[model samples]
Target: MTDLVRARLRTTVLLIVAVLVETTLGSDLRIAGVAPDFMILVVICAGLTGGTLSGAFVGFWAGLLYDMFLTATPVGLSALTYCLIGAAIGALRTSVLQERKSLLPAAALIGTAAGVLLFVGAGDVLGQTQLLGAGRAWLIRVMIVESLWNAVLALPVGYVYAWVARGSAGAERVGSPVRRTSRSAVPTVK
Candidate 1:
């Protein structure tokens, strides 16, 4: 199989696994009434590994799938929020951010916090006022705790995402050295 197809298959499997874990064990893993958002973490990983288009694509699907299991908000809310966040992260990764050992955790920290705000803000704008019914204090708590949780989990998740995305174009740009064919290196005789 080609690398693109293989990478896509791996990513799809990873998303399903993330959803399952999030739905089944998420609550149990909560600290101070906040649970880790596996879906967003995966989106962040996708952005870090793949760049803008990849991030947005993965974010939309991941959010849509996550929406199916949600009852509190409209179907496309998560999709929009995640897609925007993923794309933003990807843009930053390509433009402003430098690759480093700490990149994953740092991105996860900031991305998750932004995601929480975006989700709540979007939801409220869409008439889902209950999102803020808990008030700013609760929202702040969720943002901080969830960001911390994602940061802690980022390394392992990022490694797995890198493995899954191996051989894809964006993965090459982010994680691996590009291989130059010998034919390209040989100078053509005039």
Candidate 2:
């Protein structure tokens, strides 16, 4: 089998395992009245490592799978939120950010916080008032705690995501030598 096929297989297997773990042990691993969202962590790491399109694609599937297991809101809610979040993170990484050891945790921290707000806000806008039923204070707590949790877990998850995404076009771009484009000596008229 080709390396591309192998990478896709690895990514698929990783997502499956992540979904299983998030659905089963996720609740049991709760801390301070909130559970760590492994799926979101995976999505964020995928985005940070794989770039915009890759992140969005993974986020869509991960959110869709997560939606299947959710009873609180409509099926597409998580999918939309996660897709946007992943895409945004990936775009940011590609444009504004550089690869660094601390980037994983920072991305996880910010991504989770953004995701919580987006999920709740989108749910509320979609008339899923129950999402905001917990009130603002609860939302704040969840955002803080979840972000922290994701930040702590970012490194391990990032390593796994990198492994899974290996051999793909985007993955190969990461950690490789930066390519410089040749510039013309003469400036073109607008």
Candidate 3:
């Protein structure tokens, strides 16, 4: 399989794992009643490393999965939010963002804030006003804390993504020959 295809398949699996982790295991891992948004972190990582389409695709699936696990909001709410977040982050990547140092964590931090707002707004529109249940102060607190958590995860997640995509470890090596199944590379990248 081509590297791009292998990369995308890896991203897809990660997305599923993220949904399971965030909604299932992660939900139980709250700090002051707030759990870090892992799905957003994963999608942001994918987009920052994998490019626009990859971001959008992963974001949509990850969001949908999260929606399924979290609330009764319409299935596509999180999907649409995450999809847009991924695309926006990917587009931002093309211009001033330096992938060398500023890319991964920056994307994770900003995207996490945006993703939280987007999800909350979408939930509000869908009549899940409970998102605002904590009130504005609590809402801002959620955003700030979640953004911080995502930023903390950004480096490690981004490095793992780089390893999966380009076989990187800071300015060290090029591609290390890797094994991949060809079928895993097809539908996702196309």
Candidate 4:
């Protein structure tokens, strides 16, 4: 199979597995009254590893899958939030962030925190007052705890995402190699 096809296939499998795991064991793996948002973590990892478009695509589908399980909120809320977060994270990685051992967890930490705020803010604006019914303090707590949880899980998920995204357009961009032309090939300025 072509590399692009293989990469896309792997991506499909990864998303399916992630959604299954998140839906099944995610709640059971709570810490400090907060469950790890594995779906969001996957989206963040995709962004950090695969670049902006990759992240946005993955985030949209993943968020849509997550939305299927939520009856309280409107259908597209999670999709919008995850899609934006993924795209933002990807853009940041492309423009400013460097490849490093700590990049995954750091992105997850910050992305999740921002994502929580965005989700709540957008939900409130969409007439989902229940998101803000608990007040700012509750929101803050959820943000801190969930961000931490996602950060803790980022490394493993990132590695998996990198493997799954192998050979895809964005996968090849991570830790992009700097092109170096030989000095001898340069024309002399006589």
Per-residue alpha-carbon lDDT of candidate 1 for residues 114-144, written as tens digits (9 for 90 to 100): 9999999989988999999989999999999
* TM-scores vs. true structure, each candidate: 0.89, 0.87, 0.79, 0.87
List of clashing residue pairs for candidate 4: none
Model 3 TM-score (2 dp): 0.79
Q: lDDT ranking from best to worst? A: 1, 4, 2, 3
> Pick by lDDT: which candidate is best?
1
Off by over 4 Å in 3: 166-190
lDDT of 2 at 36: 86
lDDT of 3 by residue, 1-190 (tens): 7765676676667777777777677778677777888888777766654456767987898888887875556788889999999877766654445434544666678999998899889889888887788799998988888888888777766655556655211111111112221212212222
Which candidate would rank higher by TM-score, 1 or 2? Answer: 1
The reply for model 2, stretches above 4 Å from the true place, is: 169-190
Write model 4 residue lDDT over 1-190, tens digit each, in one string: 9987897788888888988998889989877777889999888877866667877888999889889989999998999999999889888876777656667788889999999999999999999999998889989889999999988888778667767877764443323222221222211110
| CA lDDT of each prediction against the hidden true structure | 0.82, 0.78, 0.68, 0.79
The parts of candidate 1 lying over 4 Å away from their true place are 170-190
- By summed lDDT, which 10 consecutive residues of candidate 4 come out lowest? 181-190
Instruction: Say which prediction, candidate 1 or candidate 4, comes out ahead on lDDT.
Output: 1
